[model samples]
Target: MQKQREVGNRVFVTGIGLISALGNNVAENHSSLAAGKDGITKAVHFESLYTETLPFGEVKLSNDELKALLHLENEFGYTRTCLLAVKAFEEAVNDSGLSAEELSSFDTALISASTVGGMCLTDQLYDDANMKFEGSEYLEAYGCAAHTMRLIEKYKINGFTDTINTACSSSANAIMMGARLIKAGRAKRVIVGGVDALAKYTVNGFNALKILSEFPCKPFDENRDGLNLGEAGAYLVLESEEVSVGKRKYAEIAGFGNSNDAHHPSAMSDDAVGAIISMKTAIESAGIDATKIDYINTHGTGTPNNDRVELFGISQIFEKVPPFSSTKSYTGHTLGASGAVEAIFSILSIQYSEIYPSLHIETNMEGFDAAPITEFQSDVSVNYVLSNSFGFGGNCTSLVIGRVN
Candidate 1:
């Protein structure tokens, strides 16, 4: 057993919100995950040459529908990415019972993450850049920080606000940053997560990489071929122990670790150096033995390289690995949104004492000595969970979430 060490002020997850192919809100997503439902389907809202061919974990709502739902129908310059973030952000603040005054207080902060951002308007951006359009409403919304800026303005946030873009690890880093702020006494509460919407840019890019699966992804399977791109937005409200005293906490943000291997642009090292370091550091910071982890929400992108290297990293950490599964099989790979998506899934495991299976897996990868949980399990002991998010350029992050006792 590893020696326990105190980190800092404890951070608790007071609320969560999400919108993905699985569902529109936290409750719906929880129901889908509990039932082992698969959300990947052929793209309906996104227009692309591969729309009918490659499957994606796309939210069911269209741009107009989202606008109507958000009551921003007449508004301009709100991209799909911004709309999604607003939806999830609203839910998170409501769930946390944050008031307008509290939200605008100097003790509150907003840290968001996104990769697609307004780039989801790839065609509009290109047309506007080429001066094909006289005036474009989306010209100011083309950057990755566009969504963050929108949130800051919408909520009248006055405290520290920042945006992170570490590829797939973006949201995980956002969560880590939020926790750090609370621990450092910079803020009493932090709203953190990420959002990304499907665009022709990412679709064409992944297709070019030859990593788009025609069918639903089968993560960690020996026969796993590639990943199905996904789009989603999710957020979690983290509050300091003092502020969260009267609130309902789903879990504790026990610890988090991040590292960059810089091994490859989009591939982790074969030795899993980044993964090993992040996971180990998270466990150590949490002051828990690696064996204390009851479940792991792996960053299983259904790619051959990711699955193999992640398993290698796990093997190097624990003498006996914990039971783990990939919820990406449910939501696909939501890119920047994946880290927060899986973090919420990890909290669900702790809250419900249940394990959601990695769906569509056929054969376990040979020589791994570890296979993902293949069926829905209930009444399981889920005290601690490790959620992983590894992204392009070797960015890897892990968060240790523990049950609120």
Candidate 2:
């Protein structure tokens, strides 16, 4: 473990796990990002009739492949979502250097987030619900907490565990809750993040909403169309200051803020009230002026309403908006998993003093002077990065990750 400076009452990220279309771990994802590679492609792994009609950031592993990797080929209650979650969770646990004994201790806490959960097995759930005799093996795996519950049982984790589902902001809330728990001395260490797998239900729903782009997404662009649904699982191990000492620490959780637009269920306010409030509150709680923020990982979903509003919100706060970009362009929109995925990306930027680019934007968004970082920047000095995640029902969250050095 790498030695870290003391951070009293603060939360430190000690481990990171990521499985996306880019790669299966943090190093791979960082490599793809730094190389300006985009992972969006025609859906081949996801089983959907619209696979050819739309692009998706589908992880290149099939269900059987994932099960084989996790040594759970015969597991009955595990769905695609659970398999994804387990793969990422195991990686995070190993990265954190947590022994089996430590994981089962009462001082450890688990907080995971997901929008799809076990709904990835929609057909099985539907069939089981209609059956009168012996139910399907997926009966217990149909709930929103199914993945987390499975992880708890598989690892014999006896710590506090909870699942959150607040649309796209689910995982950001999980990270925030984990930090709060550690700050309050409720847990010595907390593993927090989210997982989401592509399903016909979500794909069809977004299609019906007309936010499913047929091509690769272009965030913060003049002709930005819509989002491309993606499937991924990401996790982060956050430890309290006491537990983080002499450990491999990535970045410090400096501050966080959450808000609701309250103007629309699926759209943010025209003025970006929720986003403005969340960014301001986060900057204030971090005790830093707006000028101190070095970079921003925006929740730029490539939608017209979201991009314009996000720009307006940031403009209201920063005299000069910091270097900012949306990684969703690389991974597509991973929905519930996006927050944690981008959080990991933000920490990577700070760790390497680098910034990833936003791809395929020919024209910048109108009425905004600032544009996304279009090229990779290396060997730059970075101190703080603010990552944002906004969800349906107006849920918005912002997290500040700062370099320890």
**TM agreement with the true structure for every prediction:** 0.99, 0.97
Write model 1 residue lDDT over 257-328, tens digit each, in one string: 999999999899999999999999999988899989999999999999999999999989989999989999
| Candidate 1's TM-score | 0.99
TM-score, cand. 2:
0.97
Best by lDDT: 1
Instruction: Say what the RMSD of model 2 is.
Output: 3.2
List, residue by residue over 187-302, the lDDT tens digit for candidate 2: 99999999999988799899988987888999998998899898899999999889888999999888889999888878999989999888877777777777889999999999
> How many backbone clashes can be found in candidate 1?
0
Q: What C-alpha lDDT does candidate 1 achieve relative to the native structure?
A: 0.93
In Å, residue 66's CA in model 1 sits off its true spot by 1.1
Pick out the ten consecutive residues of candidate 1 with the lowest summed lDDT.
1-10
Candidate 2 residue 355 C-alpha distance from true site, Å: 0.7
